[model samples]
Target: MRLDGTVALVTGASSGIGAAASVSLARQGAAVAVVARRRERLDELAARIRGDGGDVLVIEADITQEAQAVEAVERTASELGRIDTLVNNAGVMLLGPAAGAPMTEWQRMVEINVLGLLYCAHAALPYLLKAAGAGPRHVADMVNVSSVAGRVPRSGSSVYNLTKHGVGAFSEALRQEVGQKHVRISLVEPGAVETELAGHNRPEVLETIRARFGGIERMQPEDIADAITYIVTRPRHVAVNELLIRPTEQE
Candidate 1:
């Protein structure tokens, strides 16, 4: 579980699971490169990590753009030495009825949730491979943060579900492609977590969610972060392919 002399890059690091995972990795002795679109939040996170005597590099970029995603990976590897771990956690969830859903929302979801993850994975793959072939850890890790929606299809979440399901499919294919190389590709599907992920929902959608889960206890970002840490911290021979974490009450 010790990651000393290794570097980890985390996307969507401004808040929620990304932020928590960054802190967790840093605590485990990995030099963390936190990527996000929000500079203020990234700086704040960096300050906290630095205060704890952990190394961190803040790279502010919107991974939805291919060039920006590439740059984020390049900068991390160039400046922080090499990327031993990558956590693709940037995503957005805009829930609503599919009949007359706003095209803008659907496009945004695909761009951020799907395209962004792809861009980051594409840009970081080479570095991950190189790190796995050499270096202190000898094995690299890529953890894609997906959702239970990927596995469960429900009404009013057609496009969001599509993006998540796509993530699962992509992760499995990549795992097969890169497994023998010692570059692990893992997928984490979270049922429901307390984060700002639902903040983009429309009023009606928000109300619908509130009514449904008003009494159900939601998991926290650290819960998912812990799962991610566990996957990445295993021995080189250990590969945790897929982890589905749902709250006990989240049937």
Candidate 2:
């Protein structure tokens, strides 16, 4: 599982799951490039990783933009050598009713959760493939972070559901396409992690969410990071195709 000499690029790395995953991968000996829009947060994360003797690069770019996404990937490969792993973790969840819901919220979700992930994956695929062929590990990993809502639909989260479902579908198809080349593509669906995702919702929606599962313990970002690390560190012949992670009491 040691990833010494490998290079990885993680999106949405300003905080939460992306941040934790970047640290985890670095700890496992991968030089990591952390991508997000918040430059200050990214600088803070880079400092922390560097303090621990890990190599990191901070790229402050809005991945929703295709050109920025492509540049992010190209710069990472140029600066850190080939990208052996890509974590498509940039996403937003604006949960609300479909009827009378702010169209902007839906649009934002599609832009970040769907288009952002796609752009990063598309740009990184060639580098990942090249890495799979040359590395001592003989494999590359692309881990897409979705949500449990990707698997199950709820009334207030219709569009959120749509985006996550699309992630799952795309991951499966891409996995099939690249499996023979040893570029392992995986989907990670999480439930009720304590992150800033819920803060993006409306006050009314937050109240309803609190009324339902607020008492239940939510998983930490590091918990999901652990799942991601496990997926990428597997042996060359192994592929952890999909993992649905939830707190013990999330049901």
Candidate 3:
């Protein structure tokens, strides 16, 4: 939990909160593996981290694919030698009324947001357990990123809410199962951070939602990154199980 010399694998590291969290973890002395579908973006993030004298690896693969997710964790352990932390930050939000929403978008959200997190967690668990008992930190940690929608669903966000809620539930169960093994599972629920998540929406709807956040001082991605850092850097006996962060001005 100290984060010094820890090996962290962060999914969705191409941009937004994941990218920010990777940088934050790297700054704390963890060797970070950045995973995402965009090779170029991953490279960019890796370069930035390296420029700051942080150890980093760029693994370009779509986490929704089971094989890629497994390969990603394997490669991280092979290259970095061990895995102490996992940040399951890869997710999608295609918000619309379910009745008229495109089936493809719904499936895509489920695949990337729900199944993707599971794939990464499945692959990372073994290494996490190994590190938990062997490393100086004495505990391994998994941080699953959820949304405020996980707790409170809105009319236009049914599927997005479902995926996030599932993440919250999964984190709770995993925590109960893994806590005895010295592996900590935590969930970070963020409310309306200013990020590229909304760009996945249909153009018109994206514009409308953009305007809604445009007036309010929404949280930055780094804000969520800071929350993640706080959780992972705690002492071994202190497991911050769940954290909900929202911008002060936002409802």
Candidate 4:
């Protein structure tokens, strides 16, 4: 479970699951590159990791842009050496009725949740593959943070469902393509985590969500981070392809 000489890049790392994953990986001896659009938040996160004697790099980039994503990956590889792990965790969930839903919501979800993940993964694949072939670990990991909605489509979550489902499909296909190269690709689907993920929803949608999940307990960001760490820490020959973690009371 040690990653003493490894470097891990985590997107959407300002807060929630991504932030927790970055810290957890660093604590396990990996140098972490935290990517997010909010520079202030990233700086704070970097300070926290550094306070704990962990190496960290704060990368402020809008991953929805292909060129920025490429630059971020390249910069990380140049500054930190090589990327042994990549966590494509930047995503947005704007849940509401499909009918009469604002086009902005759908477009934003697709751009950030789907396209952003694709951009980062595409940019980091070469470095990850090259690292996987080297010694010390001989395996690299790419973990995509999806959601339970990906596996189960429900009303008021049509577009959100579509994006997460796409993540699942892409992860599986890429896993097959890179498995023989020892580049492990995994998908982690979480159900009802307590994070800022719901802050982007409209007032009406927030009310609906509150009504639906009022009494159900939600998992913390660290819980999902734990799942991600487990997947990436497995032995080189062992690959945990998919993990679905739900709160005890979620179902």
Candidate 5:
């Protein structure tokens, strides 16, 4: 379960789950590249990791942009030498009834949640394969942060659900294609974690959803981070493919 000398790149790393995961990976001795659109937040996260004597790089870029995504991976590899793990954690959730939902929000969701992950994966695949073959760990890994909405489409979250479902499907196909190469791909599906994901919802919808979760405790970002750490820290021969985490009282 040791990740010493490994280098991991985590997108959406400004705060919440991505931030927590970045710190967790650093704590495990992996040099981490923290990426997000918020340069300030990324800088702060990098500073924190460095304060703890961990190796980190702050890369501020909008991953939805293909060029930026490619550059991010390139920069990480250039500074760190290789990428042993990649966490596609950048995503947007625009939840609402599909019939009358704003088209712009849907477009944004698709672009960030689906296409953004694709761009990062495409750009990082070659490096991942190289690291898998030559790095100390000898096994590279990819973790896609999906949602339980991907598995069960709720009534009011058509677009958000679609994007997550797409992530699951993509992750599955990629896992099959890359398994023989010893590059492990895994999906982490979280149910109702307390994060900024719901911040993108309309005011009315956000109020309603908050009221609903107010009664039942939601999972924290650290919980999901812990799950991610567990998956990536496993032995070279062990691949934990899919992990579904929800608060005990979520249902």
Candidate 6:
């Protein structure tokens, strides 16, 4: 599992899984472009990658905006040379009861979790296809980070589940569409990880989350990072299409 001479673009990279995945991929010898809305965090991440003797590019863009997402892909292709892997990890988890939930929260989730992921994938597909054909590895990878909620529907998380379920559907369909092109599309569904995702929810929702998972130890960002790194660094002929990871105690 080596990525020598390849380039990867990771979105939602200011922190959490995106940040960890960026560092992990860089260590494996890929020039990584870290994309997020926050510039300072990206700068910090870039310095760490450089200090460790890895090539990295910092791309500050709000992926929910279609134009910015397209520009990010173009800049990476022009600057980093070629994109061999794309990790669509930027997302939000705004959970609450469906009946009284704010429409704004639902809109925000759709904008980033669904539309934003779509924007990046659309812009990167051409490059990924080309990279699979001509790059050192002869294969390109795209990993979409979803949640277990994508698989199981529950009360109070109606819209959040809807967005993540959409991710799963799109990934499988695109995987079949691009399999012949050698562009690997994978979906990673994490059960529970300690990240800023939970912090975005309302206080009442937070209480419910805590009460439910209070006894279970949550996984960390690096856990998912390792899974992502595993996917992209596989032998070109081996494609790990789907991975569902969870803490041993999670149910």
The estimated TM-scores of all candidates read 0.99, 0.99, 0.97, 0.99, 0.98, 0.98
Query: How many backbone clashes can be found in candidate 5?
Result: 0
Instruction: Look at candidate 2 and tell me the lDDT of residue 69.
Output: 96
**Steric clash pairs (candidate 5):** none
Per-residue lDDT of candidate 4, residues 53-87 (tens digit): 99999999999999988898998999999999999
lDDT of each: 0.95, 0.95, 0.92, 0.95, 0.93, 0.95
- Model 3 over residues 1-251: C-alpha lDDT tens digits? 44777899999999999999999999999999999999999999999999999999999999989999999999999999999999999998888777877899989989998999999999999999999999769899999999988899888889899999999999999999999999999999999898889888998778777776777899999999999999999888889999999888777
lDDT of 6 at 181: 88
Q: How does residue 126 of candidate 4 score in lDDT?
A: 95
Give model 4's TM-score versus the native structure: 0.99
Off by over 4 Å in 1: none
Per-candidate alpha-carbon RMSD to the true structure = 0.6, 0.7, 1.0, 0.6, 0.8, 0.8
Which digits, one per residue and each the tens of the lDDT, describe model 6 over residues 127-215?
A: 99999999698999999999998999988889999999999999999999998889999999998998888888889999999998889
Which pairs clash in the backbone of model 6?
none
Residue-pair clashes per prediction, in order, are: 0, 0, 0, 0, 0, 0
If candidate 3 were superposed on the true structure by all CA atoms, what would the RMSD be? 1.0
Model 2, position 112: C-alpha lDDT score: 97
